[model samples]
Target chain A: GESVGLHLPTLSVQEGDNSIINCAYSNSASDYFIWYKQESGKGPQFIIDIRSNMDKRQGQRVTVLLNKTVKHLSLQIAATQPGDSAVYFCAENGLKGGADGLTFGKGTHLIIQP
Target chain B: DAGITQSPRYKITETGRQVTLMCHQTWSHSYMFWYRQDLGHGLRLIYYSAAADITDKGEVPDGYVVSRSKTENFPLTLESATRSQTSVYFCASSSGGNNEQFFGPGTRLTVL
Candidate 1:
């Protein structure tokens, strides 16, 4: 059984500060990872993604770092804003032959202290 | 627009009753998934379909059933709802293996 887990269940940060969310996966065969953001009442939106071959990938103001050796993945948000506050989830896609579905981690609630 | 949508944004049903949640995608993605989000459990996959008429159970598929009659539609039905089954349900679709999945606005199910 493959499992994706997060280090923290909740994260509180002040506006204008940087936010970092960490995730650890148990499946070493996972080659693809994605970071998703979900608002209070909305669906999960794709933030960024990285392949096992690459260690890092950047989006508008977000960066995803993957440490395959340690089976760790992290999402970094620069200049965090109030709108960036949401539950962030990390998912792993390691199913061989496309039989396995994405495994999501317990999300980290990002609360912004304005 | 290319996106995924879930019907009946909110649902309230009684225990032992059957309830169905509808999921539709416009991208014609090959992969569709159903997940339930709980307070501490996060998002657990209930079922997924690789293509039309092909489906499989996921981590928590005990009380759920899914059918993929069409590529754009994947619906999940709870044959006998229970109090423990009350949770937010989400439907998502992806283009291919290990690709980014687009999610729909979740349907909040309350089993009374």
Candidate 2:
């Protein structure tokens, strides 16, 4: 059974618009969460990560918001571009800090419509 | 290359055959992991090693074996390949639990 999953299987956004991808987790004890961007024919690449203690974290053009109260996580890409089109995955590391590896969700395919 | 790599990017084998996938990382990370990715199921961990000679089972470990005799290499073996074992395999390494895990390109395995 998958403990983490996305709200939608696909998301389409205009090239200049913002893109939001959402994920939900079943484990309340999970502490660390990560967002990965996986381009076709390649492996998953780490985009950003947030710990349970933090509610939000931002990177270059990506922002990750964690809502522990609702057991949800989201990744927002600002001013999406064509190169941003890819499959995004959300992963969780339990209380052990991921010594056992990460639990990943199916993923959400992001399409940048020009 | 100074990054993680997997051998035989694509492979096809028959059922009941023994197959081994090799993973090598140059960073000498302390932790290495093996995962299988299917269409519907994202990445599911098969086995992980904290360090050389220290291995543990992950979410789905059946029919798979892994050994980390050296810190830089972790190989996964399937005793008897099955059709269900056909999937893309990925290898990842991290310095520790809290660090980011760098993944290999991936190996696509098909069992006929």
Candidate 3:
């Protein structure tokens, strides 16, 4: 599998630690945002999403926080495990007309150290 | 075994040759998409289909063609393969507007 993490920012965390991956998106008009995870040689997988009207959303072991004022979004993973290691991406559906599709970020590689 | 799937997980071809990448989804999602992932650029949409017999171009549609004659199959064709087109291609599907998209494993196409 080809690695999409080349030349990308990396966040290394210790096992059982909390890891936060941050993203700054463009497009003040964008209303929907999502987080995706992609392992080496694999396609992006949907992890969670947030609508513009909401400020925060939570999942099993993940939490997505959105700040419209700063156009910032963050994914907080609790008790990170080795299986959580992968490249994470933040996407927004705030394109000019919303006709195109989601605009994805470059991605962040999460390296979990035992 | 019932999900979005892509064919020819790996392909290698020459320049100026015609190549077609197949995408099929059993979920019967109304929306389908084709994207190419590069190093610096994450994933850029190449083309998409809203439904059967309906298709549209995306950010980078040049040198590519797509057709969705059936509700479950959307195939992307490269009229003339070029070295610059070498990238991992991904196909995705969504139930409807703004819904989460399910992706296939992807096809690694290499143009020589």
For model 1, how does the per-residue alpha-carbon lDDT over A2-99 read when each residue is reduced to its tens digit?
Answer: 68999999999999999999999989888889999999899999999999899999999999999998999999999999999999999998567345
Q: What does candidate 1 score in Cα RMSD to the true structure?
A: 1.3
List the candidate 3 regions with Cα displacement exceeding 4 Å.
A1-8, A96-99
Model 2 chain A weakest lDDT span, ten residues long: A93-102
Model 3: per-residue Cα lDDT over B30-63, one tens digit each: 9999999999898888988889999988889999
Residue-by-residue lDDT tens digits, candidate 2, B3-101: 999988999999999999999999989999999999988999999999999999998999999999999999999999999999999999999976678
Best by TM-score: 2
Writing each residue's lDDT as its tens digit, candidate 1 over B1-112 gives 9588999999999999999999999998999999899988888889999999999888899989999999999999999999999999999898886788889999999999
Top-DockQ structure, candidate number: 2
Ranking by DockQ: 2, 1, 3
Candidate 1 accuracy as TM-score = 0.96
Cα RMSD of predicted structure 2? 1.1
DockQ scores of all models, one per candidate: 0.72, 0.83, 0.61
Error of 2 at A3 (Å): 0.7
Tens digits of per-residue lDDT, candidate 3, A30-113, equal 888889999999989999999999999999899999999977889999999999999999888745434456678889999999
Ranking by lDDT: 2, 1, 3
Candidate 2 stretches with Cα past 4 Å from truth are: none
In model 2 chain B, the worst 10-residue window by lDDT is B94-103
For candidate 1 chain B, which ten residues in a row score worst on lDDT? B93-102
What TM value does the first chain of each candidate achieve?
0.95, 0.96, 0.90
